[model samples]
Target: MNILLTGASGFVGRELVRELQQRADISLALALRSPGRSSGPTTFVVGELAVDTDWLAALARQQAVIHAAARAHIMKDEVADPLAEYRRVNVEGTLNLARQAAAAGVKRFIFISSIKVNGEATVNGKAFGADDKPAPEDAYGLSKLEAERGLIQLAAETGMEVVIIRPPLVYGPGVKGNFASMIKLVEKGLPLPLGAIHNQRSLVGIDNLVDLIICCIDHPAAANQVFLAGDGEDLSTTELLRGVGKAMGKPARLIPVPAGLLQLGATLLGKKAMAQRLLGSLQVDISKTCQLLDWKPPYTVEEGLRRCFGRSN
Candidate 1:
């Protein structure tokens, strides 16, 4: 398979290349905003996703294109205006690229979307599925939802196949974002008050996410489908912290703080958003994906966590 992948240097994309390159039959061509790096079997192209002009030839030749580029969430920069920037790249940029891929007769266009599109806070014990209504809270998620809408509309008008995979929180080697921060906290022996928090959240390992993406690329039913994927197990903040502690060879010192008070303090300290993410539930149901594709995750949550734990501190 000749595949065009974006965000090659990003967390998921980097591991994705490593996993996909093992197959002698797969050829990878990476599209980046700047071609400043190279690794494994990937060849780079320097161009931003915001433009409608280039990448046509490359898109025409590749059998599949996995769109993984997007503006990620930031904690302190909540009030900042990133809509224009996100729309330029995540929305308009995605549509432009998809249109080119469709015109080029590409077999499939797989979009890596965030589970944030389904919700801002956790759905408690409830699991989010592919058919749930979109309720994007922040600008980043809203932009992603817009991009998803545009892709569906485009697919309807064209014969191109569209597959959307919404993952809760993906963590693994070279992982940044909240997962990395948690690892840092655990490594430093910080006193965490999450032991009392029993919220269930689902997360995807970089390897597991890549495996699902590969399945979607070749699965016939994945066409014009929206799937929510995870590690197939939901763990609470306390449980996750314990796992991280175990992986780091240290037990997490969880405090018995009230969830309400934690939320209050976070709000007072201008960290309400952060508190919600850590204390709330963000579970996803991968049953549809599993049943439809007849696929099983190659690694369990413990194995995935161990992979990141070994890489961190």
Candidate 2:
């Protein structure tokens, strides 16, 4: 089987390609605009998939497409109108690729959506599932929701299978974004006040997420299914920090501070968003994905974090 993976240079995409390349039944093809410094069973494409590009024609020969490319959120709002920018790439660009894939008679389209589509803030201590109605709060989440609708429509019209994976905070080797910042802080031995907070957040290891993607590629049960994926265990901020510290061969030093104070300080320091994400609970229930795919995370959170921290052999 021929499989095409976009965003091959990304943290997850790079690992996913390497994971698939080792299998005997699959031929790997990577679609990327800027080639990275790694290699695998991949042939790079030089154009962006979101534009009026003719690159999809060459990829049409593949049996499956893993659409992993998107305009990720930055520290500060880069877009003049964030919603418009997100829609252009996340929604319109995604639809364009899906339509072309359908036209090419591709058997399946695998979309990697975000857990934020469920809600920006946590709903009590309860976790959101796949069947929950999309209540996206941010512009980024709204764009992903819009793209998902397009994928469903395209699948209905083209008779191609669609697998939607909504995963929470994925972390692993070469990780960037907010997760990287936390690791650096721990490495510096900075004291964190999150030890007092007991909120839970779902996270997925890159290896575990890659394994789930492999399952979706061929599993008939995954067809036309919406799945929520994460590590089976939901972890608190302190636990996560400790795990990172352990993986990096350091001890975590936490100081208990009032959550309200933290939020207020973050707001004053222009890190209000960061404060909310860290001090808040955002758990996701991945039971549906497990039941449907019969899959579980093969690596523990500590093990995954250690591998990413690069302090282990």
Candidate 3:
């Protein structure tokens, strides 16, 4: 089937492109924001994401679209109005693309969303699920939630299929941001203060997320569905650090700092929210996704981490 994919150069997009390239049955039309060179069976279309960005040509004859491009979440945003900025690109741009794609008779639209839409963290033993009401705390999460609503509305009005996948902390080879920083600290054998953090968090590897995206592209049961994607296992902060350390051939070297003291230090340093991310639980339940498509994450947490760290176990 012929498909149109956006954000072909991003972390997840890069892996998706590599995986899609190996599939002889699929043809890809990559919509990029910059002037990118096209090659092989993939065609690159240069266009930015905005209300006025032209996507008619890209949508033409495409059976499905995997929309991955968006104004990504920033840990320390410098924008004056972050919500407005996110709305302009994520909500407005996404809806613009969907409206045009629907007009062009695109069969399905797959949206890559975040677990933040369900809230920043989970309490007690409860985990975020597909049926939970959205409670986006930050601008980026709010924008994605709005975009999901718009896509569902478009699907209802225009008869186009819409599939939403919310993944929690995707990590793998070439992963950046906090994950990469953690890997570096582990590689250097630096002492970390995460030993007391017993909070559980769910993380999906890039390979597993790509596999689910491929499934949603053509699965009949995926139409108009919201699914959570994970590695099928949750881990504590200490466990995650230890795994990373082991993968990098180093010691965990974690100091047993009290969680309350850590929180207070973060508050004094104006990084309280960031500390919560490291110390609090944010688990996602992928049972609905598995049961719907008869799917399971093909890689275990350890295997995925080993692959991500470029090590063999």
Candidate 4:
């Protein structure tokens, strides 16, 4: 199979490139945004992702496309028109590529979406399912939802198989942003006040997400289906901190603070959004993915944390 992967230098895309290269039956090509991003005969620089970006050379003889590029969600976006900016890259650029890929005879197009498309948080332990009605709250989530709708409609019209995978917080060795910040704080032995918070959140390891992407590449059951990706284990904030400490061989120093008081303080400090992420529940149901594809996450949350900290045990 000849596969073309976009966003080859990104966090998940880098891992995908490494895994795909190890497969003997796959010939991989990277559709990078600029030259010299990667050094290989198969690397094609297609410039910025937009409606008019040229992808003719990269799409030639490519059987499938794994598109992972987008203007990611920003917590404090300074742009005047954040929604328009997000749509420029996430919706318009994505649909443009899908239309061209369908015309180029690509059989399958796998899109990496986010769990935010379902909503910000699930209430009362009800996990977000794959078939739930979309309720995107932010500009980024709305853009992704638009892109998904366009892809599904294009698949119906063009006969190209489209698979959408929505993954929640992906954490691995090269993880950045909030996950990386948490690891750093834990490494420094800072006492955190999240011990009393019992919010359950779902997380997917990079390996697990990449495995699902590979499964969707050729699985007949995956055609035009939306799959939620996760590690199949949900963790509370306190449990997650302890798990990280255990993986790093350090005991977490946690102070048992009332969740209500914490939320009050966050609201006073104008950090309510950040507090919600730490004190709220956002879980995903991956049972459909397992039943349809007969796939289980190869790594458990504990094993994934161990790998993240470079521990073999």
| lDDT scores in order | 0.84, 0.85, 0.91, 0.94
Clashing pairs for predicted structure model 1, backbone only: 122-281
lDDT value, residue 89 of candidate 2: 86
In model 3, the number of clashes is: 0
Evaluated at residue 20, the lDDT of candidate 1 is 82
Q: Report the C-alpha lDDT of model 2 over 1-313, residue by residue, as the tens digit.
A: 9988888777888888788888999998888776564756667664765657565545758899998988875557866999998998899888888878888878999999999899876757888989999999889899999999989988888898999998889999888888988988988998878777677888999989999989999998999999988888888888888888888888788898878888889999989778878988898888899888888889889778877866564
At residue 302, give the lDDT of candidate 2: 78
TM values, all candidates:
0.94, 0.94, 0.98, 0.99
Clashing pairs in model 4, backbone N/Cα/C closer than 3 A: none
Top candidate by lDDT:
4
**TM-score of predicted structure 4:** 0.99
Candidate 3, residues 275-311, lDDT tens digits: the string is 9888889999999999999999999999998998788
Error of 3 at 151 (Å): 0.5
Q: What would the per-residue lDDT of candidate 1 be over residues 76-188, giving only the tens digit for each residue?
A: 56545777777878998889989888889897999999898898665647788888999998778998999999999998999788999998889887788788889889888
Highest TM-score scorer: 4
After superposition, the stretches of candidate 2 with alpha carbons farther than 4 Å from their true spots are 34-39, 42-46, 268-270, 311-313
In Å, residue 169's CA in model 2 sits off its true spot by 0.8
Where model 4 places Cα greater than 4 Å from the true spot, the runs are 37-41
Put down candidate 4 lDDT per residue, 70-173, tens digits, no spaces: 89989899999999999999999999999999999999999999999999999989999999999999999999999999999999999999999999999999
Off by over 4 Å in 3: none
RMSD of each: 2.2, 1.9, 1.0, 0.9
lDDT accuracy of residue 226 in candidate 1: 94
Q: Which lDDT value does model 1 have at 284?
A: 85
**Candidate order by decreasing TM-score:** 4, 3, 2, 1
